[model samples]
Target chain A: MDLIQKGKNYLLEDNFQIRASDNYVNIVSYDKMIHFDNKEVKIQYRNKVITVIGDKLVVSKLVSDEVLVCGMIQKIEFR
Target chain B: MKHYIEVRIEGKNIYRFLKRLNQAKINLYHIRYHGINQAYIKILKEDYEKIQDLKTIYDIKITNWYGIEKGKKIIFKYRFFLLFFLFGLALFIFLSHIVFDVEVVHNDKKLRLLLQEELKKYGISKYHFKKNYDEINKIKKEILYRYRNNIEWLEIKEVGVKYVVRVEERIISKEKEKRPIQNIVSKHNAIILSIDAEEGEIIKNINDYVKPGDVIISGEILLNDKIQKRVSAKGKVYGEVWYKTTVEYPLFYQEQKITGKTKKGWSLSLLNKRIELFSFSPFRHKKIFSKPILKSNLLPISLNYERQKELLIIEEALTKEEALEKAISYARDKIQKSLLEKEKIIDIKKLKVDQNNSKIIVELFVTVYQQIGMEKKIEEIKKDVRDH
Candidate 1:
């Protein structure tokens, strides 16, 4: 059981995972949301920055390890 | 995990408050801003307690409880109605399996009563719970086997909530003809035309004129002129018989004619009572035909259709020839009904014709070739011999 848990942790070693679709954006293991508004959302994870630009963007779900952004997504950028 | 509370946070810095709540690891869902200063958020009931620290920074109030808590509240409020609905459903299911009526279909009263008793012995009477198909079939076999000599076939059918038992009774054929000491006597005053003796001596010859009581066939058997034995006499004796019949007919006859006016209606028949479901017939003179629509065999209720047709009555005068022909045919029909199976009319002659006020009366003599023999017991003949 210990070996299985360590292997699972290694497979999920990525600090932040970002997924974007036609109308929504989902980010997992994000450090914090630096900016959130109607037009854009800026998120910070580890040492990288992720930005989501959309219209009428709303935070549909916000939890400890993940956030779900919904509504009319236009672009996404990572730096 | 499913219980939730809708909280409305009213403050100038609601976004900052949301960020702070997210930092505090508070899960929020379905977050919507009502205006610039007020926003609504749904959170788990357990997580709602953690938002107490934000009371100093923003005003938070629980608007409503949802999910399982809301369902529990509504159920508690209408508990009596739910209980009654469940009880009614259970009663309906239970009553559907009960047999309200048992019907034994038979024309003979004694047989019907016997079958009813037999069915009762198997607990298949009224007010009993209906048995399943396999059990009913088993009971049917058992009963049929018990009365195999009397019952030809048996069937138990369920119609709605009633059980209808249809039974076919065994028909035993008649026993063979018994030969007793008997004699064949003339049934009418006639002249014997032919005689064929099958089991006895022919006492009367052809062209013999005899009365109703004359013996046509003798049951006595003789050897050397002594009565050796006596047997029942069986013979076919054909004779020429005469009948006088009088028939009368009015010159004017009234007949009913259909006028083609029709009306259709429906009725409900329960037991021996009938209730009309539609309007009655408007025509005064009409013929009515009723037919029942059977929805189920177990239920006594049935829908019936009644069709009524209007008729017209008309009178017409008959001619002389028509009146005589009609009178003769009416007389012939009356005589035909009384004739035996092998008897036939040979000839008819008009004896007299007379006319009264408005009717004509015709008298005729009809000749018929008929079996004129009938059996007479031989014991009566022996009694006469002993008395003499």
Candidate 2:
């Protein structure tokens, strides 16, 4: 597991999870790191996530890993 | 430390940037804005390093400026003094008019009125201001020279805009006294004391009382009731007149120094001033008469400096011997003043001075020399009134 999964597993042991479709890190289930090639993508680490809608950055919850960028909408890819 | 940098941000960005800069402890000494947009900021050298990093946050521009703040302050200070100096100068120029005083002096009212009218013609009147001194002086000189024979001297001096014209007039003695030639007659029934006769016939004896209007010395002589010759009946009749003069004793005489033993100074009429026989005294105990001048009296002028004298002021004290002699002398003088033709004193028999209640009362007994009597007769003069 990556450092992101390690921080997420630590939260999962305390009944925490990361939700992808809602663009947030919550207590849903253990989810792997989902990287996207689209410009609008949600980045998750530990029990928190941030969605970058174009160049604008938005944080969904209080977490150690959060970053968002929102501007011109362009292509996106997951990693 | 980061290198220093300056920033010129939009006007709307100043509030946010200044707040952030202040939170970061960036010292801003001088801050100025131009056209409501660009702001020049001066910061401490320590804060310059960190402020340069905020370029990405604020559009920053660097510009070098000289010390314009201190220069503006100095200019304001000098401008203030210049304004005050100008105000004071204007005030001084404004108050240079307005006559301070007007003085008029003259012996004759008619002359004063004439002079006043003449002065009015030359724009000189009471309460007038804005008078030109040189022009007034020239005008005054012209007028005075036109009447040089009448006017003695005149001068006009100016203090501020007020003028003082002092004048002096020529002296003109213009009076004559006339004496009447009349016959001398006895005023009452009395004994003849003494007589100094010019030309007259004696008729009565001494220690004899004569009737009123009775001729003490006759102008004409008569033998057996017939008129003989005519003569001038001129003589002084003096009698033993009783007088009681009371003078307060311990007269508490007070005298001040009159003549200063130094070079003359500005005169004061009171004590500490002396009148040389030539110079006139300004003050007198009494005034007998004053003659005024025409046109000169209205100009604060004096025609003459005649000194008046009063006998009440005693310059020197009288000793015991001097007092007795003076008493007799004063009695003699009184008798002489009362007589028509001058006569001498024959006797001062009784003189007693008694001090009572801070006073000395003197009673003098006197007998004077005079003509003895009058020859009573009227001679008829032949006057032919045929010539029309």
Candidate 3:
């Protein structure tokens, strides 16, 4: 149809989004938090699972956009 | 906008509680984990109940609070003190603009009473609201103008809540003080008609002719033509004096008598142009007495009360004899006004009369008996006993 409608459909339709920086990770459209601890946090969206491994990792902010984990982030693994 | 607060949540399943909070659309900020099971998070104050409902599944304890709720609790705790402080500040501002007492600085009781009355009329009395600088200056000017002969200088000073009025009385300077040992000299070359001496020896008798500067009443108390003591010569020495006056009388006289019907109204004047308000019935011949109500110093515009009194004019064609009699009376009045209260007019002799155009000019010699005593200090001769 139109470009704006296509963009709205893209935003509304089920899609997983993740942003990771040196100190924090922001995730959007996640199903739930599978596990959370001092050293790592695991989140699952649809049929996929995302793993965040870090030191002193904590959920700094949370909204409908899943969670934002902040700390010394070493690596992120998705399966 | 909802106010958010930072609270510490203590529970065994803290992570599960955060997940449930996010699912409920409750936003959290600045989260920190003290331990694995205990975490601190920020949430909106209204959403605290949802977190409380999860207490059955987990043991939830609130450790601290923050933001708008914290501020509201602190304000509610000291609301009474804040109210009293605000009320006190408002009262201070109101009391500063009120006058509690008026103090008039003067020694004379009558003068103080008069000034107080004048100040009361100008709205500067006790318990009145304080006036600004310009208004006070205007009031001072009005009072000075109303009592110009009574007050020479006036000052209105404000000290805290009191109005202190300082005034100076206008004392009319009288004649210079007479010496203790002085003589009353004849002021003019006349015949002394009467003498009333309060102190001193009478040197000249009644009906005696005297010249100017001649001592009529002496201060020296003499016994057998020898001086004993001296005193001030205080008395009224009545003498007959003459005046040569020429008065011009009109052949036709028009006397204006006020009918006593006076009308007072407002008048606005711009420069030399005046406009009277509510002047439906006008007086044909009127004498207007006006006092300014509002005057502009910068512009030539003023508003004043115009008190107009109706004048009744009586016109009469005078004959030669009537004109001459009127002229003699006018001359007698002129000389009589110059005399004191006790002084009397003895006679008026017409010397000459001449008709000029529409009037007659009469030359008259007027005789008035008045006090002619003027004090003259005596020169005392000091003969030193050591020189003798």
C-alpha RMSD for every candidate: 13.9, 26.2, 17.8
Stretches off by above 4 angstroms in model 1 are A1-14, A19-25, A33-35, A39-55, A71-79, B1-14, B29-42, B52-82, B176-388
Counting clashing residue pairs in each candidate, in order, gives: 0, 43, 0
DockQ for candidate 2, C-alpha atoms: 0.01
Model 1 CA lDDT for position B241: 96
Per-residue C-alpha lDDT of model 3 across residues B1-388, encoded as one tens digit per residue = 6777767777777777777777677788768777767778877777778878755656555555676667777778888988898899999988988899989999999999999998888888888889999999999999999999889999999999999999999998888975668888898988999999999999899999888778888988999999998898888899988778889999999999999999988889999998888899889889989898999999999999999999999999999899999898887777778777999899889999999888999998878888888888775212222344
Q: What lDDT tens digits, residue by residue, belong to model 1 across residues B35-67?
A: 667888989988887898765668889888898
Tell me each candidate's TM-score. Answer: 0.49, 0.26, 0.50
Per-residue lDDT over B291-324 for candidate 2, one digit per residue giving the tens place of the 0 to 100 score: 3322243454433333343423445554444555
Query: In lDDT terms, how accurate is model 2?
Result: 0.51
Best by lDDT: 1
Q: Which pairs clash inside model 3?
A: none
Interface RMSD over true interface Cα atoms for each candidate:
1.3, 17.2, 1.7
Give the CAPRI rating of model 2.
Answer: incorrect
Best model per TM-score: 3
- How would the docking of model 3 be graded? acceptable
Score each candidate by Cα lDDT.
0.86, 0.51, 0.85
- By TM-score, the better pick of 2 and 3 is 3
